[model samples]
Target: MFTRMNGIVCLTMALLLGCVASIATADEALDKAFEALKTYKWGQDRATLGAIDAAVVASHKDDAAKKDLEAKLVAVLKSDAPQAAKDFVCRKLSLIGSAASVPALAALLPDEKLSHMGRYALERMPCDEAVAAMRDGMGKVKGLVKVGVINSLGVRRDAASTAALVGLLEDSDPQIAGAAAAALGAIGSPDAAKALGAYQAKAPKELKLAAADAYLACAERLLADGKANEAKMIYMTLAKPDQPKHVRLAATRGLLAAAGQK
Candidate 1:
């Protein structure tokens, strides 16, 4: 998934790209940007893409501008581009993708070489359809691919996956179980917190630390959202001496924070 830092870099690059595109014709600008996506070169082709990226974002609010860019992107996906070339487009889509891009992005989910980046785009695409696509994908893939899907859903904070994630807490693969635990924490809902709490004794010893961390995260979110009492329950549980010293400290601090809520 793109981090805040990546978003910052993309925005900065887009601004510079905006300046570059102003000097080029419409056809010249897009062709140059498409070429840059294939180069995957930094400091060099990034300038071309930066201009293209800026154009996409600036046009998002205007239906015609958005559709034009979206069409160009779809054309790139439909082309027989190399995996590297396609991957480059996926990164751009993550920044400005909508439901229109879902089918193209969704196609990459089952591909071993591309599933990671595929999820990367789908995770950031702000639409109910994007969420549904990933959620549906969870059952169709397995092992690490499924793990990737789980992680993306977590990053998305898809509360709808709470039950599915809770079910995954029982998987024999420790990593899968651990990922599920961490994802539940990312969700940080009252029910998610309860599930994490319930999974405590059943989760492997290797999984407890993640559970603890997630517990704290869920509690903190609940506290912040005016659900202090619910948050306090988690805080009290983790504040127990049996929890690791650091977790106990965090729980204590959370308790104090919760006390100040309305």
Candidate 2:
């Protein structure tokens, strides 16, 4: 009986060793596939990065595994990789990153070529640090770069950023002003709606359309928040004869919708 038991123990140990080797092999394969993302391009004959992407990893990995993978990607962001490669990594960060990736991502926000991609990652990172990074970028960057960061902030729906966005409304650059107005509209906070309404009355004709659209968006948001009275006021402003015909018509429809809300 002792002899048979000893043989069984040996067999079990061998099987466990084999299983360990198999798992090790799988982890190495995944690592190799991820390396392909460093310089991947669309329509390539072999796109190995797809096999180890955020969606795949998230689906397969436990919390610990996911954190380990995220740390690796964050390290790649600081590597001497080409901009395109970094951009690819940034895109992946959107689906996997957390506050830990913020510093690496923030470093790219001022890069003219990479700011948009950088913000692309930051915008989707579900952490306060991400918003703070973009908010800081607002004051540090310029022109379209600034606009991109502002847009990301709006997408975050950061009510706390209302004052900063409102300040941009007076920027000399019309594109910047328009983008700020649009960002505020996307935020759709009561403060954002009020700022747009105040600016719409005196904003140049060139910026009127943006303000109008923003007003309409804010109204829809207010209605969703169960504030039909506030939404109606925005709709009323947009429906006036002075507003653009298409915008006024849209507002007219929005007005009816807001009124119908219980």
Candidate 3:
């Protein structure tokens, strides 16, 4: 019995040592990858990043490793690394990043070259901080950068951005206005529905049809959420003869669905 117990103890110690050695090897690999990342460029050998990618995959079930990887990625974002390196890091962060990564990612939102990658990470963060970062980014960016942030906010279904988005509906740039309308529709809140309804009359000729479609989208979401009366109100408005035949047809279908009909 003494010999058997001694053997079991030896096996346990061997397993522990093996795990420790594996962890040490992974750490060394990550160190080498990060060193290579500093000078990484678009057409460079991607094998340099393979270690980091492997670390990310291994992090899935290991929260400590995930957080460690995220911290390292965030550090890279704060560095002066090439855009290719930053872009790769942001992509990895999108998968395992937590709120801790919010500030670093947010800092890149106004950078024309990096904004989209930053948003790519923030969009999947699933935290209020990420949403706030995008919202704050809206005021600092312009043109297409601003549009990307607006789109990310909508993708998040952030009702908090509805008021800001409503204001954007009147932006002088039709693309901005159109994107805001679509985002509000994607949000599909009561406030979004109301705002879209009011915008219909004032919508520029170029945007009139887009606004109507957004309103329809809002109504569809409302109906799905058990807000049938509100949905019906929007459908009835779009069903008016003055609206286009296609809009009317969609509204008619919405009306039927709202009424719980087959």
Q: Judged by TM-score, which candidate is best? A: 3
- The lDDT-based order of candidates, best leading, equals 3, 2, 1
What's the lDDT for residue 198 in model 2? 98
Residue-level lDDT of model 3, residues 1-262, one tens digit each, is: 5798899999999999999999899788889999999889999999989999999998888999898889889998999999999999999999998999999999999899999999999999888999998998888889999999999998998898999999999899988999899999999989999999999998999998999999999998998888999999999999999899999999999999999932
* TM-score of candidate 3 relative to the true fold: 0.92
Q: Would you give me the overall lDDT of model 2?
A: 0.85
Error of 1 at 171 (Å): 1.3
RMSD each, Å: 11.7, 2.9, 2.5
Candidate 2, run of 10 with poorest lDDT: 52-61
Score every model by TM-score.
Answer: 0.79, 0.86, 0.92
- Using lDDT as the measure, which candidate wins? 3
Which 10-residue window of candidate 3 scores lowest in summed lDDT?
Answer: 253-262
User: How many backbone collisions does model 2 have?
Assistant: 0
Q: TM-score ranking from best to worst?
A: 3, 2, 1
Q: How many Å off is the CA of 19 in candidate 2?
A: 1.8
lDDT of 1 by residue, 120-226 (tens): 78998889999899988887877888888989998999899999999999999887788888889899898999998898767778888888988888887788778
Candidate 2 per-residue C-alpha lDDT over 17-80 given as tens digits, one digit per residue, 9 for 90 to 100: 9999987877787788667756655554355765567334554547777677778788778887
